[model samples]
Target chain A: MDENNLIKMELTVNGEAVSMIVKGGRRLLDFLRDDLHLTGTKEGCGEGECGSCTVHLDGQSVLACLTPMERAIGCSVLTIEGVGSPTNLHPVQAALLDEGGVQCGMCTPGMVMSALDLLERNPDPTIEEIIEGISGNLCRCTGYKKIIYGIQQAAQELQAASPAGTVKESVE
Target chain B: MLYRKYEVAQTLPEALSLLSSHNGAVVRPVAGGTDLILQLHERILSADVLVDISRVPELRGIRLENGQLVIGAATTYTEISRSDLVLKNAFVLAEASKKIGAVQIQNMATLGGNIGNASPAADAIPGLYALQADVVVCGPNAERRIPITEFHQGYRKIDLNPGELIKEIRFAIPAEGTGTAFYKYALRKSQAISVVDAAVCVQLSDGVIKHATVALGAVAPTIIRSPAAESVLIGEPPSEDLFDRAAEAACQDARPIDDIRGSAAFRKYLVGVCTSHAVRSACERAA
Candidate 1:
């Protein structure tokens, strides 16, 4: 936009200020993986055919492969790396670990990203909604039954934990 | 081969200026860049300069002005599906918009980009045709409005010029006696492209057909209206016989090809089936 101005973008990623010099064509997935060293958002298909590169763009789930870095300049981004660790666990991470949801773990982050969006929209979703939520994400392993099972477990855990106070207001 | 440098245009004028300067140099306006990028990856299409226009705020939102529902060219399918205005006033548009690709695709794929792509199986073409939408196109020097029916010239060609870009799509809201509906026949419910889709908007006068616009897609090189079928509904009483005749006539306008998605005969059959459903849906809404 500002050819001369050379946009100096500043954003918060995983609760940290992330500043980077991004071109118009640089997709957010590339910037995160290359510059920020956050390889959790795996790139399955760079053209958005697969949701393996899903990430939280301003708290909404989107395919990072299609999202331009310029748009994420001022937005909040959260990848799988930000969600939880092997030691400390988010409910989804915990459920995914507890269940055998991690087949190859290639599409896990994207599935989690999409499931997070689903939970935000429909907290107590049916099996169909859960299936619909992760349909965009392509998982080569687990036959998707385990992933669905993992989501159900996570929903139960999240519901019991009572995130009404933790869950932010809907962006709708 | 898919790799290329990108230039983001924050303003409409700047984007247009690039278009004017580039003469068939493989420059394209990127909205969601979903389909375009995939086509490039598969070596289906090629572009040198991807003029990023996603940041242009001018090409977004839906509004009602002068009895017409005006939608910005860069508005996403997700935005269209979620808009209460589209759900109430332009339900057919919303219906088709929701069925496009999946959630990730819908969240980024723009309505104008889909229309401009000029593909044979575009989900929104029939809906826009049923609405009688006017595509407002802007070129270097001036702008003009072209009806959606006449926008496509061939299978993958459009009426757009070298320096032109679609600014907005506008159509008059349906009248009090009119009801609109759109139906898509895809392999999968949400993600798959349409095998055959139909949009029917009917205007009835006390159970008599006052006017009818029946549009069908994916059954021909481009989306088309069955003049033969539309004529039969001019003054006839809405009934099963009318629907049968309309569907039959609608099938006559189709010339589908046997592709990986479906066979020519199957698509033809779907034209009739979808037309019947579309007519029934609109009739129910009108009733």
Candidate 2:
């Protein structure tokens, strides 16, 4: 019953294979923030309602607060840091800033993660899809207009990037 | 928050063994920690020990066995929604899975945990009940099966014994020709608990209801089946008048308690509306 009898677990976080052992009930969100010192993964509701703790478990977005540390054993995880950086912003991240999507900054990480996963799965999503994609995340500020528009702008930018390869193919 | 003890068994046997040693403990089996995490932080539960079943490989994946689908306890809602078998065969479950929590919650919450948690409004309950689902559990002494109807003991209570884990949920395939639908009625579209939820399974032939199963959730302490409504519609042509009568009968079992979301009166109204909608939607699918 002593939770500290830890087991060394091998996991790939942000594309790097790592190992650790803390406690049996240590939440994945806590492990990321407290152990790995990746505090970008915020915890809001702790329950599944708020998406503030969103992270990617093997590429699909999931609430990190709800994911057990043991669930991540021998699996892959992608935090907000994994997706984009300030120096090299993902299209969604860039739009969030340009479109003024950040307000309180609590829900930005989850919103961006959701949008990134959405675009990867759906190259071009409708407005309904955009709304549905971010439905789980609760943003106290911004009224979500900027966030939706940001995702739309990011989708267009991604589309614009594809035409270059298409033009090159035609020339060849 | 106060610090609490946590335990992760390397193997399920060890976990079960730990449970026997500590009787009458508040230990919980965690797949997606979403529910437990909130319960712990809120002081609703001290969480003396969180048995991390997620690390066990045995509790994962979705597979078809014989005519039933065997879902591993750790298989996330995201996986089930994307599964071709669940999409094609268990469309109701797939639909329900999509609306559960959010994409983030879907990626962590598992079907077994959903049932094991026994939330009145858990998306999987009504659909699984409509499908006439069976739960498989592995405990220290033996493995046993319980029908979904008998699974929930009360609000936030399940019949599962201590030192036991939900192994899989199984349901038989539809007879020859049939279709199903799950309807969730919440004030908001997503990321909210249901005011009322309904699932309908109907098989039709010659423009008549050959058979039907109707189930409702969140309107009672436990998920309730509308045997009265189902009886009225079976072998009879589903007409507007009949739909109205069936809905009224189903509403009888709905014991909605007043809360912030809506008044008990509204939920009572929803029982009728959701039941009718679920029936109509299911009929359309069958057609």
Model 2 lDDT per residue over B99-214, tens place:
88887787778888888878888888898889999988889989899998887878888878777888888888876557788888897888889999898898889889999998
| Local accuracy of candidate 2 as per-residue lDDT tens digits, A65-145 | 766676687789999888778799888989999999998899999899889888877768888999989999989899999
After superposition, which runs of candidate 2 have C-alpha atoms over 4 Å from their true positions? A1-11, A16-25, A162-172, B1-26, B55-57
Give the per-residue lDDT of model 1 (tens digit) for A72-124.
76779999888877788888877887789997889999998888888877777
Per-model TM-score of chain A alone? 0.88, 0.90
Model 1, native contacts kept = 0.31
Worst-scoring 10-residue span by lDDT in model 2 chain B: B1-10
TM-score of model 1 vs. true structure: 0.89
Candidate 1 chain B has its poorest 10 consecutive residues by lDDT at: B1-10
C-alpha lDDT of residue B82 in model 2: 95
Winner by DockQ: 2
